[model samples]
Target: MFFHIVLERNMQLHPRHFGRNLRENLVSKLMKDVEGTCSGRHGFVVAITGIENVGKGLIRDGTGFVTFPVKYQCVVFRPFKGEILEAVVTMVNKMGFFAEAGPVQIFVSNHLIPDDMEFQSGDIPNYTTSDGSVKIQKDTEVRLKIIGTRVDATEIFCIGTIKDDFLGVINDPAAV
Candidate 1:
């Protein structure tokens, strides 16, 4: 899920950025520091939207850098349990397959796949139904329900399942 959230942070500005456009420098730096970074409380920062307020700058004793408390609005992506997501399959093996939904990587184990599908081994490994009508392979877009999720400092991992109805391949590159 994507969220528009307001977050506060202390931004440190270098001496070179003390002139005019300091706010612009600070915002650009904040975007570089916060965007694409995952925080346990705020999830993954997608993009900085707008600045709410910039507090008075406090000068450090030795470094001479100015630290300002800044509140800003940004977009974030956070996945939760039972959330259904469509992701492109990246890899397939006997154990299961790996798919990516933006910055989040989802793993769907063989046990979570429908019983009717069987894993096939070859140059292009895949899982297909007995009739070969339904298939999941690389570049396949699948709708899966997140069973579990873990957020780390740099990455978000999820365990997903497609055993239920309406949760499976939505698009197949092979068909195109």
Candidate 2:
């Protein structure tokens, strides 16, 4: 889920950015540094909303750069167990399929798919029901419930299932 959160960070201002537009420079730098930065605690930092406070700058001994304790509001995306997410299928194989929900990668094993669906092999691999009515393939949007999650320094991986009712393909590109 996406959330608007307040976060704090120490920002270093270079001597070149010490002029009249220091606030603008600081905000731009903050966006460059914090945006796309991922942490185990806060998930993925989406955007910097507003600056709440900027503490007094402390100068370093060797460098003229000033460090300011800045508190800012931002948005983040974090996934949790049992959360239902709509993801686009990226790859399909005999084992199962891989889908992406934003920065998170979700894996739905064959064991987790509905029993009525069977995996078919071809130039365009897919999983389809016996009657060929329901199908999951590349670019298909599926609603899945996350069964497990693991967050790393650079990536978030999730194990998902679509066996339950109302938790399967929401949009089938092939059907279009």
Candidate 3:
């Protein structure tokens, strides 16, 4: 029979692994931490759920690799339903305007705008109401709606509409 030593009973044990009891215990402990950290680290920096291990290419946009158990600092933004909130117009497309409402981002669709309006050729699409009146540009200081999302995750997505009382200006979003 081979000699064996456990040092003390206050230790967790694994089947006699490779060699030393101490070595086996250390490996076992390290393995536990690795597994736990890896599982907990798979998440988005923003609000979200149903996490999947992100691919290297998914976050290769200059953000270095995230080690397991991300150092997360939690902040919450609460928006009430049907409330009119002001935000800076960040992106404007034919479809709508993307704005930053407090901590959350929102989208405002053009259809929501009253009477389609006009901006530099491609700035705002030509919007003519069914009544044949030309739509005014709702493209400045855009007030938007807390519409919908781009994806269905725990992280909330927002949308806006110019048809409502929302307004936006033709400007860069990051400037705000």
Candidate 4:
């Protein structure tokens, strides 16, 4: 899921950036430090949309660096258990396949795939139904439900399944 939320952070500004361009430097620094970062609580920060407030700067005694309390509005993506998402397949193997939905990598094991689909091993490995009407291979877009998630301070991994009704291939690259 994508959310627009406000988050607070303490930004440290170097002494060289203390002049008139302080605000611009601070915003740029904040973007560099916060964007593309993942946290257990916030998932991944997609982008820094706007600044809500920048509190008074506090100077450090010895380093001369200033710390400012900053509040900013940003967009974040956090996937939860049972959430349905459409992702493009990146790899396929006997064990299962790996797909990516934005910043999250999802693994759909063979056990979770429908029994009707058999794994075919070849130069172009794939999972196909008995009739061959449906197939899953690299670049195939699939709609899957996340069964489990492992959230770390720097990354988020998900286990998904497409066995349920209406949750399968959305677009087949081979068809195109």
Instruction: Give lDDT per model, in order.
Output: 0.92, 0.91, 0.42, 0.96
TM-score of each: 0.93, 0.91, 0.39, 0.95
Best by TM-score: 4
Off by over 4 Å in 2: 171-176
Compare candidates 1 and 3 on lDDT and give the better one.
1
Best lDDT goes to which candidate? 4
Q: List the residue pairs that clash in candidate 4.
A: none
RMSD of 4: 2.3
Q: Which of the two, 3 or 4, has more lDDT?
A: 4
**lDDT digits (tens) for residues 2-111 of candidate 2:** 99999999999988899899988998999999999888778888888899988889998899999989999998988889999889999999999999998778999999
Which consecutive 10 residues in model 3 have the weakest lDDT in total? Answer: 1-10
User: Could you give candidate 4's per-residue lDDT for residues 1-176 as a string of tens digits?
Assistant: 99999999999999999889999999999999999999989889999999999999999999999999999999999999999989999999999999999999999999999999999999889999999999999999999999999988799999999999989998646756
lDDT of 1: 0.92
For all predictions, the C-alpha RMSD in Å is 2.5, 2.6, 16.5, 2.3
Q: For candidate 3, what is the lDDT?
A: 0.42
Give model 4's clash tally: 0
Ranking by lDDT: 4, 1, 2, 3
lDDT, candidate 1, 1-176, per-residue tens:
98998999999998989888998999999999999898766678899899999999999899999999999999999988999988899999999999999878899999999999999999999999999998999998899999998877787889999999889988556755
- Two-way lDDT contest, 2 vs 3, winner: 2
